[model samples]
Target: EDQVTQSPEALRLQEGESSSLNCSYTVSGLRGLFWYRQDPGKGPEFLFTLYSAGEEKEKERLKATLTKKESFLHITAPKPEDSATYLCAVQRGSNDYKLSFGAGTTVTVRA
Candidate 1:
């Protein structure tokens, strides 16, 4: 079975606080790991795609890294607007676009 789970269902942080959110997953055959940020009432916006362990991608204050069994989304110096739900998805097998999404970690940054 393929599944994704995120820790700390909700995180409250002060402005400029740096923290990392965890995304633990178990997939049959890992093809690709995807990271996305979703705002309220909106769909997920793609952030990064990691194909192998030790691979990483970054954008602004957000950086994502993947491993054989899990992934982490590190946020550096987050601001109030950075508050949002971060989701992780995985695509297993060749040509498999079936995304298994996590419940997501809702982060709130207080400025």
Candidate 2:
């Protein structure tokens, strides 16, 4: 079984403040780690996919990094628009269609 754990269920940030979110996991066969952003009452939006340790992806103010046991989402100088629920998921090597997800970290950025 694959398990994922995310820290600090909620976060509050001021506009332009930077912080990092953590996602830790343990799985039988690792395939890929995924990051997503979801707004209230909306579906999750794709952010990044990491296939191996040391892999990283970035877009605008967000950076996603992966390691053997964990992944991190770094937000740089986030704006109010960046406030959302950040989700972490894992795709097992055995199944390409199924993903195990963490509870997610909700961020609120105030201007």
Candidate 3:
């Protein structure tokens, strides 16, 4: 069984403040780790996919890093528009279509 836990269920930040969200997980056979951003009424938007430890990906003001036991989503100088629920999900194996997801960490950036 694969399990994911995201810390700091909710976050409040000033417009230019930067912070990192943590996603811890345990899986039998790790295939890939994924990061997503979801708004109030929309489906989750894909952000990054890390296939191995020490891997990283970046887009705009967000960066995603992967390790053997956890992943981190770093927000750099976030703006009000960056406010969203960040979700972390994991795939168990190479051919697995099912994903285990965390409850998500809701980030609110105030301008």
Candidate 4:
């Protein structure tokens, strides 16, 4: 069965600390993997899309990389403002715009 799972459901980081979040998934007929950042009370903001293994994407302090079975979101020198819930999702087969999202990793950066 196709599924997505994230570890360390919640994390607390001192300002300027760096960390990496994990997203493990298994899907049949894989299509794409996506990452998003969601602020409190707001919808998720698109971060990256990985189409194949060994693909990587970066924006600001966040870098996302994918492998055949999992993906990782690495946060570098995070600030307090970077606190948010990072989500991992996947689309398989002909799902079109549909995505299966993992539980998400909530990160808090405190000064």
Output the better candidate (3/4) by TM-score: 3
What is the TM-score of each predicted model, taking all chains together?
A: 0.95, 0.96, 0.96, 0.94
Descending-lDDT candidate ranking: 3, 2, 4, 1
Better TM-score candidate (2, 4): 2
RMSD of 1: 1.1
What is candidate 3's lDDT per residue for 70-109, written digit by digit as tens?
9999999999999999999999884656799999999999
lDDT of each: 0.92, 0.94, 0.95, 0.93
Give the clashing residue pairs of candidate 3, or none: none
Off by over 4 Å in 4: 95-97
lDDT of 3: 0.95
lDDT of 1 by residue, 5-109 (tens): 999899999999899999999987888899889999998999899999999999999999988989999999999989999999999875655789999999999
The ten-residue window of minimal lDDT in model 2 covers: 90-99
Cα lDDT of model 2 by residue, 1-111, tens digit:
789999879999999999999999998788899999999999999999999999999999999999999999999999999999999999888845469999999999999
Candidate 2 RMSD to the correct structure? 1.0
**Candidate closer to the true structure by TM-score (higher is better), 1 or 2:** 2
Model 4 lDDT-worst window of ten = 90-99
- Candidate 3 local lDDT, residue 8: 87
Q: For this target, which candidate reaches the highest lDDT against the unseen true structure?
A: 3
